[model samples]
Target chain A: MVTAKLLGLVFFTCSLEYFSLPHLAHRLFPAWSYLLSAIVLWFIPIPLLIWLPVISVIASSCFFTRRFNGGADSVMFWVGLLLALTYTTADSKTHFSVISVMTIGFVGAFAYFMAGVSKLLSPQWRTGETFQWSLSQTCFSETFPILRQHSRCLSLGILLWQLSFPLALTHRYLAIFYIVSGLVFHIVNARVLGLSRFTLAFSCFYPAILFLSHSGDH
Target chain B: MVIMAIKGLIFNKRTLPLDLLRLFFTSWSFFDRPGDSFRTRLTLYQDATPILEQNWPETVSFKWWQLIFNPAGNDWHYSKQLESCAAILSQKYPSEDFLQSREFKQYLNHILKYVGPKSFDTISVLLEVKKYSANADFQRLVFLTLPTTNKKTFI
Candidate 1:
């Protein structure tokens, strides 16, 4: 229940960020539909059965119209759908089952792993040239002089961290460390790069990370 | 896994069902490639007279509080759409054939509406893309001219 609520709040923030944009509308519906759904998501405590379909329809609208904000939107879609299914299971009234939490954790880990692998395959990223260039394009490049100076080393470190993210499931302390560090990384990206959605979207899965790590402790 | 997801989700021709599935499996390659400069501009023409012009990726100022409700992300997405259309148009297709292609028409329709409530006899969207290498020098200079050119440059 806690995980679902936190995810919902994140979704609400994402939705607001999306619908607030001027003149971007669905092909078949007005932009206000999204605003309305976001209001319902936050103000009204609708049951999972009721809210799941509502959000699914809205998500479908965003997808078909090519308005889905980022990859986090997709992750949230999968998480919400899967959580709805879990809502039908025994003990779901209290909390998600171990399998469900593990599944969510695995999905988050796979996302990070794939990101690292993709960066590894890119020669520009490997050389940190792309990182330097991207930072140079940003408005806040002057704020992180140390980051620019050590771009290659930091890029490689980030690559390794993403690749090893799945190991967080193996131990609680490691999970806590990864989650905390991951939050810091995302927070920095959000503040510097204006990728605030990633901070909220990725954090939605942290609960699963914590849950799985605790389960492994026993 | 990303390749598998793309194969399973995307088809040669897009449809409602395919897009719905694709929504759940968005590509996860964040910053996998070097950042390139691309800009799209729309010029509205009325009976041989260019009236209004608009540039995509409209200017945005980042704020500390915007971390909670940033609209720049959507702006980025729209700019990417313009860039994608520009890429397709750069495939060396004949101007007439490319203009009549379904891809261009769909993009035109969307962009037309996006440009707001304005009626123009014709609209032209130009994409300017600059790709830099390690050396940071210009190469392969090409000039654009209208089909009815007779020693006269469009620019």
Candidate 2:
């Protein structure tokens, strides 16, 4: 169980995300910024790796205008910060692995909670109309296209899934219920709306939450 | 004690939490339908046709390679650019007072460069502050313009 490897994977993924769209960095810095970023994050060690997160946060804030970075980016930054703290510390009671795991759980649950609350705030969500609209809008499977044909049932199912996210914390069975629902929801998100990044970024948190769920009181 | 004091100062007015809610949540409220709610759309039109309508598969693939495979990225970044641009181009922008705003100019310039072809002559931004009442559908479309006083309206 190499903490560095796991954190490295997550950090590497989040950092190199810039390379795919070099135009983002090209706006802030020159063309060499992506190459410099790749070099620093990968080749450099802890003394320098600490700066990667700082640069990432600064770059993200500057690029996204300080208020609009999504929850996945937020999760990555928080974990990066924890990893940075993990680097400098003397390996006391608070280990980097433990803290990163906790951040994932907290952020994952928080994301779901906020999403549920966001859904509740919308009248369209209450009426299940947004689901109907989304179903029709997305380019999904044959089953989903047919699901769009029967809007009422699909809409209700979506409503139940969106609101049921909090049940993960209530009991073991309920937690599994929410977990399965989340998988299905994100699958639909990818298969339908083409939001596959969400599926990968968020799934990182599931194993931790699931382990916590199993260990917690029923 | 310091945490409590800071929390008291920020939460005393209750502005921070609501702002946080807006920052973290997806699109303030997902209620896109006509209502009392606030909705912002970064509608980009090129050659009189909408960008999304044109199908940007070549622009950026809708495939998994562009979506899930790229761990370091997602479409979230693109949407953020639009959201922030719309925020800067709020309805209050058309007023004479905002004409000299350097930040506004920068954002408008960035959005034009990011989305549309550089050779295109005109870039039009339409901000609709819509409020729906039981009696009437209240919608005001503010056509945002460049900082120049040239009187050449793109909209």
TM-score of each: 0.75, 0.61
Summing lDDT over every window of 10 consecutive residues in candidate 1 chain B, give the lowest-scoring window: B146-155
What local lDDT does model 2 show for residue A20? 48
lDDT of each: 0.62, 0.48
Off by more than 4 A, model 1: A27-64, A91-96, A136-147, B1-14, B42-55, B101-124, B133-155
Predicted complex 1: CAPRI docking category: acceptable
lDDT of 2 by residue, A13-51 (tens): 544554445434232221133234335545564555565
Per-candidate iRMSD:
6.9, 8.9
CA shift of B92, model 2, Å = 3.7
Put down candidate 1 lDDT per residue, A9-30, tens digits, no spaces.
6656655655565445442222
Residue pairs that clash (backbone atoms under 3 angstroms), model 1: none
lDDT, residue A134, model 1: 64
Clashing pairs in 2: A17-B72
Across B45-129, the per-residue lDDT of candidate 2 in tens digits comes to: 4455544422211223345553445422243334434434554455557656454554444444445444543333334554443
